[model samples]
Target: MCRWLAYTGTPVLLDTVLYKPVHSLIDQSLHSRMGVETTNGDGFGVGWYAPDNGTPAIVREIGPAWSNRNLREIADHVRSPLFFAHIRATTGTPVQQTNCHPFRHGRWMWMHNGGITDFHRIRRELALAVDPELFLDIEGSTDSEMMFYLALTFGLEQDPPGAVARMVGMVERTGHEHGVEFPLQMTVAVTNGQQTWAFRYSSEGASRSLYYSTEVEALRALHPDMAFLREVSDETRLIVSEPLGDLPGAWNEVPESSYGVVGRKGEDDLLPFTPQPV
Candidate 1:
């Protein structure tokens, strides 16, 4: 399990979200209150798209984010309208930069906060399912990375939700075939530079915790004296594994088995998500 945050709105320095929050992702790396583990210090990553750049810039490391000077330096300097940050706590996978979250390919970036139940039993079948053309790009040995590639093989670029449904369906089917009772668990985030999609689901009824910010204008009215609210755009939004701080009415839980989209024009939409067989 892990902790992650995705920001989309007006361009803001990365530190605005990564470091300034009272319970920031960096702080969560050492003291996560809701994660399965209290600490997620195995490794970490951040991905962001620069203005006019279709591809994202990714910075990852194989050490604790709390003590990573490089992460702090970059966060203080880089500004982006859309970005992703994750801190990891290994679930059997080795701790390595290549195994970090916010995996990227071309203009797309993906991060996950759950595991493929009994992944080792179904690994070969799932690995074989990835498009051979994309197989060569697999750089890490984590179920989360494989899940991203599986979605890609199922046409993620054109249909993110549909692709993920098919991906989950395959994982569940493979798990059942191997005698696993519940096969999938995930709270995932993906983006293609323009629109961002965040999903919460599991084979079991309950999934991990995921929340998104309430509308900025509403928060402004609730806390008129907060200077930070005035600086960001009305459309400013954040989707996270957990709330960054304790601001009342500032965050809303993403519905179970549903997905949300933050579009290029700053439109927000929530839709039901269900796994479908490929």
Candidate 2:
């Protein structure tokens, strides 16, 4: 289990989201209210896309985020329109830097807050299913990273939602073959420097908590005096494992078994998500 957030909007210092909220990601690393664990201190990572770079910059460390001086400094210095921050609580993998969240490919970034049940039992099978070329790029042993590569193999670069659904379908099919009744759980986020997509789903129908920020225009109407809301663009939004603060009408729970897209053209969407057989 972990706590993560994705931001796509006007460029702002990472500190505005990671450490400024009442229940910020850094705060969640020690006092999370809605995660499986109260403290997610196994490791931490942040990835941000600069205005000119197609590939995002990621900083990961195998240590508690709450005490990480480097993360604090980076958060204060970096500004980007799109970014992802995650605090990890290991399920079964080693607490190593490579195993941290916000895993990267060529120009895409991904992070997950759930696990594939009995992953050790089906690891070899799933590994064998990945495209050989993409398989060579896997840098971590965690199921989260494996899912990223699987999605890439299944065509993430061409179709994000479809690729993820196919990835889930493959995991579910393989898990069933191995006798694991409920094999998947995830609250995932993916971005390629422009738009961002978030999904909440589980094989058992009870997914983990996930939320997206209310529309900036709507929030402005509700909290007229909030200076921060006044500063960001109407297209700005945040998708998170949990709400960042207690601001009334500021967060909306993502529907169960559904996915939302915060698009670059401001054509945001929330749609039903069903795992498709690969």
Candidate 3:
């Protein structure tokens, strides 16, 4: 349905993955091999942690990314240790800036590359599930954004994976009540700038694609002559919806029904995610 990537590791220019990869995110917008559709040109967005303020900076527009000169220019100049890039294809939802992915809530930033089944049937109940105090912050009509807010309402800042599991459980329950099967689907990326977490799951048991980078040291040993690879710190990593290129050993598929986080210490972790009905 869409293509997205999340990176958390060494600080590097945004283009390293956005434009430099052979089948970059920009290219994926026009030619995706694993997504439901090859063309995801509905819109694009990029968010990164700035050097001055780790508050998270975002640039989004409802236009094809390849045609955006501003994005091209910024990609060459801006760099960050953590960032998110998304290429969207609408799923029966309005096209608008607020609907753009890599959404922010104080410290957290999020984006998604899939849709919820029978969304309209369950939208009202899902929305009503949000805490009243937090519901006012919602700014888009897409289930993706609502999913983000739902996670926040369920303690996302304190626990991203837990919040997401809770949100999915809620969606599944609502969908079942509405007689819709396999109601949740997503390849999601969420970050607090300092740390990042990604999830791949679908109620139908076949989720969208997601992948993460190998450690820089491992890559360096495998492809020693690559100059650009040498420039990056040993900790550098990238998670994408598709391999940026056909480079041998450049990416690894995320396990089925699982999620991973990127960072030092316990900040970067991955665990099995299975939501029991509530």
**Model 2 spans with C-alpha error above 4 angstroms:** none
Output the worst ten-in-a-row residue range by lDDT, candidate 1: 261-270
Cα lDDT tens digits for candidate 1, 27-125: 999999889999999999999999889999999999999999999999999999999999999999899989998999889999999999889989999
Candidate 2 residue 193 Cα shift, in angstroms, is 1.0
**List of clashing residue pairs for candidate 1:** none
User: Between candidates 2 and 3, which one is better according to lDDT?
Assistant: 2
- Positional deviation of residue 162's Cα in model 1 after best superposition, in angstroms: 0.4
Q: How many backbone clashes does candidate 1 have?
A: 0
lDDT for predicted candidate 2 compared with the true structure: 0.95
Give the Cα lDDT of each candidate: 0.95, 0.95, 0.86
Candidate 2 TM-score over all chains jointly: 0.99
Tell me the spans in candidate 3 whose CA falls farther than 4 Å from its real position.
264-267, 276-278
TM-score of each predicted structure versus truth = 0.99, 0.99, 0.96
Instruction: List model 3 lDDT by residue over 1-278, tens digit each.
Output: 78998876667889887998889999999889999998998888999897568688899888888899989998999988788899889998878888888788887899998888889888998899898988899988899999998899888999888899999898888888889888889999998877788999989989898988777788888999989898877777788999998878888999889988777332456788886454
* lDDT ranking of the models: 1, 2, 3
Better model by lDDT: candidate 1 vs candidate 3: 1
Candidate 1 wrong stretches, greater than 4 Å: none
TM-score of 1: 0.99
Clashes of 2: 0
